[model samples]
Target: MSRIADIAAALAGYDPKALSVDGVQAFLAELVAPAILRERERVPLFEALGRVLAEDVVSPFNVPPHDNSAMDGFAFDGAVLDTPSSGFVSLRVAGTAFAGTARHGALTRGDALKIMTGAVMPAGFDTVVPQEFCTVDGDTVRFPANALRPGDNRRFAGEDLRQGLPALLQGERLTPAGLGLLASLGQAEAPVLRRLRVAYFSTGDEILSLGEPPREGAVYDSNRYTVFGLLTRLGCQVVDLGMVRDDPAALADALTDAAERADAIITSGGVSVGEADHTRAVMKQLGDMAFWRVAMRPGRPMAVGLIPRSSAGDAHEGAAVLFGLPGNPVAVMVTFLAFVRPALLRLMGCNAANAAPPPMLRARSVAPIRKKPGRTEYQRGRVTCLPGALPEVRIAGNQGSGVLSSMVEGNGLVVLHHAQGSVAPGDEVDVMMFDGVV
Candidate 1:
């Protein structure tokens, strides 16, 4: 059987009318595979932000390269203070150790070296008394016997990153800290997978593009822009297909064109049981597709499958995965965040383990929530924290699927689970924040 057939067979038991959120996620995880890039190019460290590492980065040398002082203090032999007779130990300063200077000779007993922070430790000193605890007079320093232990405020060589160790594993995404770490290792360039190319469009006869004159019945297309922003943040090379009318020919042409040029194609609108929608029909002609009624509010109608290349229609020509999102603006964002985002990450060569759903935080509801026990609800909410209290959340005024303003007014989604029913005012709910993607 074909790969599509195998996926279909695996999902044969899924009840389209009442599918669980977990069930949809599990099916997607198994159906999609990482698209690893064979070609890798080096990008400058400054340009490597948000890029995934294509190769393991091994350290060429220890981070510090030498033992050093972690603070501005006096470095001395801890043995001299092991048995101080009067609860204090005094040591004559032999010399000063400054950062960037060469290593100094060993210190004799009852002697110390005035060392600055990050200065290489002298040959025989294993302890440092911070300046705050030391009394310095001319060439001598005094410290309380118990103020410092045998190895206080000293940084050993290779403590952070040892030589020849893997500093970063393959498939790791580079953060600000990661870039700094790479810079410390003297890496000017990073090996990263090429960005994935994603093409997206909106399907609706009543949808209007920007700069077009507004009409009474037509609505401005917002899904395309939202999808664009999301894909751009993920670092994908995005291809905007603009707005396609609800005609079979127009959709088929757009799908074929997008499939030929991009790694994935995303369309918002026309996966539902609407007479004006031709997306479902065109999708079936292009490839094997599954139209699902997921058990989730505002995003029940979804389409997932692969669109074969136009020319050879063979595996070699490659297939572009399709994610047909709901038409409602708020629903578009919710469904994309829940399903399409992770799939796009996997297609970009990110590690499967790192493509899990965004984490949810527990928050107390400030108002009662009316919900059914079957379908999961993603209600837009305003979450706030009080002093010494748990985070409190309340749903934005309108819960309509088409209420885009509600999404704009809220910071997160109150995720009512599939088995959960109505919730009282003080009940706890799981909320997914929009600050960052997992």
Candidate 2:
């Protein structure tokens, strides 16, 4: 097991006192290892939404399985089209082929089969002319000679997916379309990894749970609820530890209990240098902890560590990682999106692409923003896109860290990166959208 000091010492220009946002990310990349996997969980197709596949999903057989008609049309040999001297080519109607039915024998050069969409093509037929394009008589069908080329409107076997090839990869998350693809392959169920178990709670005496009477200098605990929603939306199996007071012993007990049962632990509050903050002390006692003052707005203070599941209370490699977030409403979410989310995805065994942060999009600023160099800032914003114009963005609400309303009205975060100065109205800025994620 690599000690926390060793990991910090390995990074170039490492500074735990004042870490950059990118520096924090790089450290976490080395800190979090993939969770130990158990046997693959076999789940019915209908019930496997957002689950990661335990192994490659291979196709059992070719999709379509055979050549078929792409539409309601007449199937015939395309060779006759070239031999005809007339401007239009005609063929005698032989028989009808409906979907789910098969026909035998070949269609002679001058003969055509009236075939519906998805009907298996009979022997010796390679083209199909849509019914609307052809003029049909009682026993003959006619169409322009150049209406389509040879092999037109005919779907070849294995076109969608071939047999013995991987249709979906391991660690790939299943969405609605993925489930449909499985159904198309005639799979009744899918094999997926077990759900990731995440434990979360809010810490601080000033924080109150729901139904508790409000008192002076105390506020209702909103962080826990927001944390709950975020974890569940990510399809994690969430363990809500509720709100713990400022006492050191209670905090330690809650964290120890959570670590034993969950793959990761998240807590909001008691990470700063406030008098009541004992999270750092307890974390260092139970695990190898690094309390960092990150160079980022709203979420500058955080604690990262690894906690052992055994009763010995000593943290080692490959155990549960802890993320102690700031108490501010907005900070908790910001740190989660910027840091914790990516780490969790990695622990979930997701591939690089899926585990990366949501892409940042370019947007023209609607107004100037005052920002200094040396730290990153995330401002809540609403984007307006007009036809034939680049999308424009403006600040949404109060940018206070403790005020959570800012995150609610906005659809994205206007990312003013480190080393960037004041933004002008027309300057292009980056925005991390919250369309489906928030």
Candidate 3:
């Protein structure tokens, strides 16, 4: 074993089955620090959705560029209503103005213009009376006393934005609303962080391809699809390398190809200490591998490494990071969210996207909860919010990572503390909602 490997092994303790999930998460984060982002690119506004921003976006012009009206009414001064029983003064309608028009004319005393909502408020007119409140007869509008305020109906120019302001900071992922903001500022193209090229694969002979006959004790591969969806959601350019058997040579070749073509390589299964697990052996031959047993349940064994491939004939030179998740579906999903997602975001140059939000929701446990001490458990659960009350969460049908139905039926992940052994019915706990489901 290499010196780094030995140190890692000593620091991480033994027994893959005994590694806590928290330990594994911290180890993974430390192992994959400083993942450099790819190159930058200028893409159209339509194509920039979901892409990370390469540079700060500044507004060339202020929003609303000019002062506008907030309501459809007669534009006049509010001080004219200081006297009581003013007895309906009729102001001459000088002209009409609408939104997006330049107001070159100014209002005079006893002269009001019919202004529409969003219309540029003419200089000298500080208030607007809703057209519904006053009757317009020919060129005169009858204004009631105290019908308007000095600034009640005016929307000042640049109130929404200022000229040349830093509207968006660098490392912001473009969302639909973000794109709308860009469009409003007349930005047709955007400078965005280049898409991350991620390579993925699944191991184990028991994992069959879609539409393939399932052999006894074998299950169809779903991790690839799930990871693909998750990566897509994260705006990654995924390259599916398909499934490989538990052969050391085949695994090495796949890793080599992935390192050359992708910035990061993600694989499921085959890193455990079992005899059929050749992923660790292949990684050791290729690069620096660190296997850690975390303190979290559902996910325990995970592998992180910086692959150092030799520049021999047909081999790649630069290092490509590796994340070896567990074969179990739930374990793989949880591990990816807790560990892989942060690294991926850093590699994509998104600063805030990697931050994990707290799952501190109030939930009442409907059934008895059983968990061992010293391991944090993310119990798949279904949560329902009672109107005007806290949400209630119950464990899904089963807690096994291999049970796909459990995740499908779950609305959230009920987080049980590492020291909490078990809880009886009606105990309140914290749950993280999935897809915003309560």
User: Model 1, range 1-438, lDDT digits (tens) per residue?
Assistant: 766557657875677666777877776666567344445779999899888888899999999999999999899988887878999989999989899997547669788999999999987799999999989899889989898788899999999899999998888778899999999999999989777788999999898999999999999998989889888888888999999999999999999999998878899999988888899999988887878899999899998888888554222247888888999998899988888888777766677665666788899999999998988899999999888988999998698999888988899999999999999999999999877751
Candidate ranking under lDDT, highest first, comes to 2, 1, 3
List the candidate 2 regions with Cα displacement exceeding 4 Å: 34-39, 80-86, 311-318
Worst 10 residues of 2 by lDDT: 310-319
Instruction: Find the 10 residues in a row with the least total lDDT in model 1.
Output: 309-318
Per lDDT, the best of the predicted structures is 2
Work out the TM-score per prediction. Answer: 0.94, 0.92, 0.86
TM-score of predicted structure 2 = 0.92
Q: Give the Cα error of residue 29 in candidate 3, in Å.
A: 4.5
| Best candidate, TM-score | 1
Stretches of candidate 1 off by over 4 Å are 34-36, 310-317
Off by over 4 Å in 3: 1-32, 81-92, 132-149, 309-317, 353-368, 419-428, 436-438
lDDT of each: 0.85, 0.87, 0.79
Alpha carbon deviation, residue 258, candidate 2 (Å): 0.8
Estimate, for each residue in 58-162, the C-alpha lDDT of model 2 and write its tens digit: 999998899999999999998887887887998999999999977876568889999999999888899999998999889999999988988999999999989
RMSD after CA superposition, every candidate:
2.2, 2.5, 4.0
